[model samples]
Target: MNYTLNQLRIFLKVVQNQSVTKASEELHLTQPAVSIQLKNFQDQFEIPLTEVVGRKIYVTDFGKEIAEAAEQILQQVSTIDYKTLAYKGQLFGKIKISVVSTGKYVMPYFLADFLKMHPGVELEMDVTNKNKVVKSLQNNEVDFALVSILPEKMKVEKIDLMQNKLFLVGNMEEDFTKKKKIEAILENRPLLFRESGSGTRQTMERFIVQQDLKINKRMELTSNEAVKQAILAGLGYSIMPLIGIRREIQNKDLQIIPLKGLPIKTNWSLIWVKGKNHNPAALAYLDYLKKEKEAIIHSKFSWYEMM
Candidate 1:
């Protein structure tokens, strides 16, 4: 019914080391003190946590669950400390950023550059799928998200970083330009698709529907890298941002088919929960992105034709 923070800390240490004696060593407490804390923790709860299996102490399933929660609880306490320090003009705290997987290609380079410019700032980057990134942003687990898509009707501020031309891609071995129209190449060939919830997928889907094309029949892969590999393997063609496939196109490994009115151009945005207190570092990053968007894109894929 009652628990102490020391008990929680000791329980976490035991879980971390998976040995009471090792936990005692780590906590600078005696083995008996560590055992007592574990016992007290179990007594406060309805279930027992530690059991001796042969020569080692192990946790039950219930204990494992509690240990997991304890980790989060301790993490929150650390966050509070960081927040207090930040509030007191300590501009050297960590900022967690969750970005869509595709953004990994560009976001990390930019972040590294930023950190070099401001060595006092710490960054924690989580590259994830679109849905998970969105969920993390919504939960405030991340300071900001560098994403390609914004949910409709969400209270988020989007900064239009840049507009990119989505291209129809085929292998360089194929004469894509020979085809007068994009529809001519669309018949029976397998069309590669990005995983669901991808902004690129949504853009492609909307373009398909607008053109009255059928959505059935295709392979859906998770990452842009996978899609690129599929395309390189001649699995099928996909509509992808030019930034993603510039090297392949230049190396003469891939060819572009120009559709008179195909590949609906879209913008990438930097987003955060609106009306929430954002870290000053986050705001500074946003401004940096806006001010240097064109330069960044140009430097990365200098040869790619932009629309």
Candidate 2:
């Protein structure tokens, strides 16, 4: 009950790093000082927050819950500061965004421009799989998420930012230059699939089912880079977003497999939970996205045709 914000911050740091020593280093506090505050924080709570085993600290289930709460509190405090600055006509605050792995290709340009225009704004970006990004958005852990596949369960306010072209790609050495029918490709070639729960994989599966096509799953990879590498090594062909493989295609390392109904069109969307009150920074960035999306896409990715 007597824990201060500083104490909670130290606790959060410890939870994040899983080491008091590391937390102390990052916090610029002596190890003993960090231990004392951690003890004070734990003493205020009836339940144990963390346990030490083999010289490593691990957060308990209750600790995890508390960490989430602490993060919310910290974010709220940060928002208060942001709001105060906004009242004075200053654009400043931290914006946390999570994007699917493929979005990494394009999202950075937007962030870079935003940061340049609003020099006071701080940005934190998490690049992860679509499932984790969705979870972060659902939990209110991020201000916005960039993704192609929207979750059916969550009530989200989204805008179509751009088109994501999904293409069947293979190694340049493969004889995919010749146009082939979807049915023949699926029947003859081994198909590389993204790991389950990926937005890319989900879209590809839906397309396969809609077209009544069957595939032989040759291998499953977790990341786009991994899947691309597998394809480059002649492991198998995969359906991937054009954003992630543009350079490879340009370099002649990979080639698109022309098939009927290929290049599935999906929208890249900027989304946040419906009814969530966005901070000024988030609102400003959203406005920027709305106003500059076309220019942003064209300026950064002019080489690729916008579908």
Question: What is each predicted model's overall lDDT from 0 to 1?
Answer: 0.78, 0.87
Could you estimate the TM-score for every candidate?
Answer: 0.69, 0.75
TM-score of 2: 0.75
Which residue runs does candidate 2 get wrong by more than 4 Å? 1-15, 19-88, 186-189
Q: After superposition, how far is residue 77 of candidate 2 from its true place, in Å?
A: 11
- Residue-wise lDDT of candidate 2 within 1-307, one digit each (tens)? 6789999899999999999999999889999999999999999989999999998899999999999999999989887977787788889977999999899987888778888988769888889988899999989999999999898889999978778999888887657667877657656557888888899999989988888886654678888999989888888788889989887988989988887787899888889999989887889999998898889878887876743
Model 2, residue pairs in steric clash: none
- Across 173-290, the per-residue lDDT of candidate 1 in tens digits comes to 5675455655567665677888888877887888887777764558899999999998888788888887777678779888777776665666667788898687777777777777
Total backbone clashes of candidate 2, pairs 3 or more residues apart or in separate chains: 0
Off by over 4 Å in 1: 1-90, 305-307
Worst 10 residues of 2 by lDDT: 180-189
Which numbered prediction scores highest in TM-score against the true structure?
A: 2
